[model samples]
Target: MLIGEVARRSGVSARMLRHYDTLGLVRPTGRTVGGYREYSPEDIRRIFHVEGLRSLGLSLSQIGRALDEAGFTPSTLVGDLIRKTEERLNREQELLERLRTVDAAEPSGWQDVLRIVELLHGLGSQSAARRLQAVLAPAEGVSVPAEMLAEAVLTESDPNVAGALRWALARAGGDGVASVASGMASEDVDVRRRVVLALAELPGDEATVVLTDALGDPDTTTRRHAALALGARGVTQAVPELVGTVLTGPNDVEAAELLGTLAQDAKWADRIMSALVYGLTAHAADSAVRMRLTQALAEMPGTTALDTLRQLSRDDDRAVALIASALVEKLEKRLDDELGQP
Candidate 1:
């Protein structure tokens, strides 16, 4: 077959065929009287081989190596193609996410679009300071999309930056709640923790609802954080978790303090009293637990908590007795001071 016939049959353009010949990729096996190129059957087979390799994303040089190199194997090249394809897919997914986030912002114009892109870039920046600035960036003009803030806060590891991102998300109202809530179910514990922290800062019924649901998280720390945030929001559901944290070592002090805050209200007073007293029986033999319980009594107001403190003053553990007796003294004086107040 002549070069033209070869081009027609193989779908390879004549110019490309000539270039292939120049590169020694597929030189015709013969020439006519007019000195025009003519391809033999074997040459046509080589041309098909090159085309087949190119279909697998091989560069021209790679195709040349695959066809000519004695030791060349398709295994290594196929592996590399698979890796490259995966990388490309990941990049495309990230880009699509960014575009969706930008679209969700409802930009007024190209300028607004550009502003959001810049903020998103900053939020994802390698520099912690830049990420912080992105969350705190002056929103006097264009607002950063809530989803962008939500995603950033979920993955943020820096304490200071996470706080700022939370604040930003909160100011965005409930916009990021859905995104943050999704993070609550993430397989990654860190992601779940970060999302909960952000949810705590957010102001909305959505945050309250999510935190209340988080009370059952299998992760101890996750539930504790959720309970603390819920307690601050006046959700009585946090009562049990807060009380449990008192028995558990971690966050016991803060938990005790939060429980005391809950105790101040008459609505939760009896429940709080009963729960704390029950906590006593649950840890009656543990002197350290008794001491923590005594310390927590000082935070509760009114006669019931006062009476409980008096009984604990006589606890069998000497250290628990001493701590309880001191707390009683402090409470007696504090009660007297309160009575004197106008």
Candidate 2:
């Protein structure tokens, strides 16, 4: 077949077939009477092979080496091509995400676009100070999208940077709660914890709802943050988790404090107190657990905490009895002082 016929039949352009011939990738096996290049059946087969390699993202030079070099192997070269294609795909995806965030910002002009782009870069900066600056200042000329801030806060690892991002999210306060809410279902424990922390800083029923939903997170830290936040919001649903944290977590002090605050609610007072009492009773068979539970019970309010303390004061464990007696005396005095306040 002549070069033009090859181009017409195989969909290879005539110019490209000539280039292929020049590269010796598919030299024509014959010449026409007019000296036009003519492709043999084998040459056409090589052309199809070149087109196939090109479809696999092989460069023309790479394809030439693949076709010409005795040692060249498609497995190695195809693996390399796959890796390069994946890298390109990742870069393109990153670019697409950046563009989407920028569009979400609804930039008014090129200046705003550039400003938002810089802020986005800073949010992901390796320098903690730069990330902090991004959250604190955001941009003077451009508005940082709330969802963008939510994204930054949810993944930000630095304490200072995370705090600033949360504050920024609150300050930018649109429907960013929904943005943070998405992270609640993340399989990453750190992300769920961070999302709950960010949601805690936000106001509105949406943040409360996000924190409430995060109560069931498998991550203990995520549950702790969510429970404390929800407890502060008077979401009585967090009482059990908060009580659990008080009995065991490193943040038991804070958990106890929040539980105390929750117990002040008339609606949840008895239920919260009962949860503490049950936790104490469940640990009655164990001294150390009982001690922690007793300390936790000290955080409860009303006569239920007082009555539980009284019951614990007569316990068999001397140390628990001692601690419980001391707490009971202290609480009784405080209650007396309050009643006498009139």
Candidate 3:
């Protein structure tokens, strides 16, 4: 069979089929004497597998690897594909249940639509509230017009709606969502922020570019969300940017909190401690930054972080002093127990 035949039978575009071929996802098994690509029965089987996996949210890369790893077992791969789809379906059903409780009539379906938009995009907030009324309509049943949903999903120019879509894409959680998030990353600030958050939900090679792009977002809140998302991925590849976020991005409480959580990794602890120390130095300069950083450092577990907090207690800054003294006292008790008995 030719590419056209594969496209017709699989319901994938001819161009996309060609692209998939280049990705080595679904390749022709042979070629004709005239040089046209010749696909085999085995190739057709693999094409269906590729289509099924693509539907279930597997990336071309993921599907190709899975195909190779599964040794092309049609039945087994189908089951695996079904399981992945089922997981996403379950999550969507949960969202549907929550949607029922969230009074859609209260505000023209703004919040409910926005939630779906967020799930579609990755992250959003109330300021984007007005934008939600358009994306989500008040429909009781699940049978929304595909074109209506697609138009709402794609045509809206509202930054908030774009952001909401990014959030929704994140919640979508699969290769398909990752692809959508990747495209959304190039949008405006609010949209990009949502895209970063969405990428966090679907962490993959596609996410790497968005996360890196987010580090430079001018909006402090967006940057904070990006930092938190990167922290959750725990991508060591992201350590440098995470360090930058801690040291200079924005004086945000949530970002600081995320940095502390990320410090649990031994590879990241020294850098986290450095950021804490820098934040402490500025404690005398900015009270708000001081308080947030102090709160952040206290939550960091283990001796190294605790000891640093103890030392900071000696500072003239009262917030720093209080948290450090408390943590040090706790550490002392732990040390005594560890060293006293055996």
| Number of the top TM-score candidate | 2
lDDT of 1 at 283: 87
User: TM-score, each model?
Assistant: 0.79, 0.89, 0.48
lDDT minimum window of 10 residues, candidate 1: 136-145
Best by lDDT: 1
Q: Candidate 1, residues 178-291: lDDT per residue as tens digits?
A: 988999878899998887888888878988999999999988888999999998888889999988888776778888888888888898988888888898998888888877
Clashing pairs in 2: none
Count of backbone clashes, every candidate in sequence? 0, 0, 19
Q: Model 3's lDDT to the true fold?
A: 0.61
User: By TM-score, how accurate is candidate 1?
Assistant: 0.79
Of the candidates numbered 1 and 3, which has the greater TM-score value? 1
lDDT at 228, model 1: 90
Residue-level lDDT of model 2, residues 217-271, one tens digit each, is: 7788888888888877878898889888867777777888887887787788788
Candidate 3 on 131-250: residue-level lDDT in tens? 464334323322222222322344445666665554444444334444444435455665555555555655466666677666677776566666667766665544445545555545
Q: How do all the candidates rank in terms of TM-score, highest first?
A: 2, 1, 3
lDDT scores in order: 0.85, 0.84, 0.61
